[model samples]
Target: MTDDLPVLRGLLASGAPLTWVFTGDSITHGLIHTRGARNYVDHLHELIRGDAGRVQDTVVNTAITGWRADLILGDFARRVTHWRPDVVTLMIGTNDCTTQWLDPVIEVTAFAASITEVVRRARDDGGIPVLQTPPTVDLHHAPDRARIGEFAQAVREVAAREGVILVDQHAAFTAFSEGTGPGNDDMAWGLLDDAFHPNAAGHALLALGWADALGFDAVSSPVRTDLAARVAVARHPQWPPA
Candidate 1:
């Protein structure tokens, strides 16, 4: 509704085949937290190819475990540009908040600079850049990284200043936490596998946000609700079978 992804919509609406490259840290990598389940990009891949009838659309995931924006820049061309993607999705800043032995300001400043550089390089290399803010974490368990909110703020600023397509995953997760976050123990609000990494359900939320932003009719997809539906079985006995 806000016209956030006009360029991407144009590409999709044009009905021409296009490639999308996803790069970021473990969150985007669909690490152990996903427990062998598909990540958000996988869901998007299905939407673009199967649902949207764009069978030729390509989705590549070059995300790495424990990597940050600075680390991605170290080998940008290989991980991103080499694919000659039409759209490049960046969902970083989580690990940037936890980098060891660096001042908070320094880490965020470097993170912002690295993000900016990635956007510039993506645009220069003929790719539309899409920025996704890192999702929320359980501060009670990750007390050391309590200031992660600052990093989210930084991503918002970067998105606004860069004038690129913005997907506010952090805001979405934050709203979820505010509404249904457990009173205690389940600090992650049942969305994360641990204190940080998102689990399958969390990944579904991420997918839903991206899908909605990319103008997909996501409400009917398993990616839009409890992803466990795709598991072919209900997560709890109290719930009906998927």
Candidate 2:
């Protein structure tokens, strides 16, 4: 088993309730993109519960819409540490990288420090910290997608330096989108609700990524699939919306 898996496995083995907190921006909060539908965060909790008997895991989402790394840092104690989580996942940086050309260096430096502090705080609170790179933006233009990619790299650097579990969602989304065809544009559009937020289909792709990152193969559940399908169809009648 991977080093990261041991702690999670032990948590499951212990049979005690597990509290996991997911903190980030609108993505983690499931904004307009997932208003009435299930997002990655929702599916991830279910994915972890799986078929494990008596594994009661509570997932607390402290993410707010349009929150940047600095904003998150300011509210860390009240939103994150107060939950007393057993596992804490940090997935910020999307907002921090927007229009980064205006303050590229500051964005990089401040973003990195914010991520490092989040992980450090989680550790100090006796929670296992997991770092997730923010998924890419659909816009391929100058200050949008490329800069987000840069911030994703910053997240990777922090994960390595902090020695926390790294869930490379940015890379996973890129690969998943690339498999669709030639340029990354088409796949990027296919998954996004807007330039930034993910639709239900995009959320499913995210759930898959989180499962892979956690070293757990997801079991298809008819209940969850049906719920997702109903929501997807209701949102957009088009069969292959994504």
> Can you list the residue pairs that collide in candidate 1?
none
True-structure RMSD for candidate 2? 4.1
Error of 2 at 66 (Å): 1.0
- State the TM-score for model 2: 0.82
TM-score of each: 0.86, 0.82
List the RMSD of every prediction in angstroms: 4.3, 4.1
Identify the leading candidate in terms of lDDT.
1
* lDDT by residue (tens digit), candidate 1, 1-242: 33347777787778899999999998999977888887888888887777677889899999998788888899998989899999899998877886444555446777788889999999899998888999887876677666677888888888888887788988877765443423533243556777888877778778877877777854355444445453222222221115
Local lDDT at 236 for model 2: 27
Instruction: Compose the digit string of candidate 2's lDDT tens values, residues 47-117.
Output: 66664333577888889987877787788897788999998888887778877434554468888988888
Winning candidate number (TM-score): 1
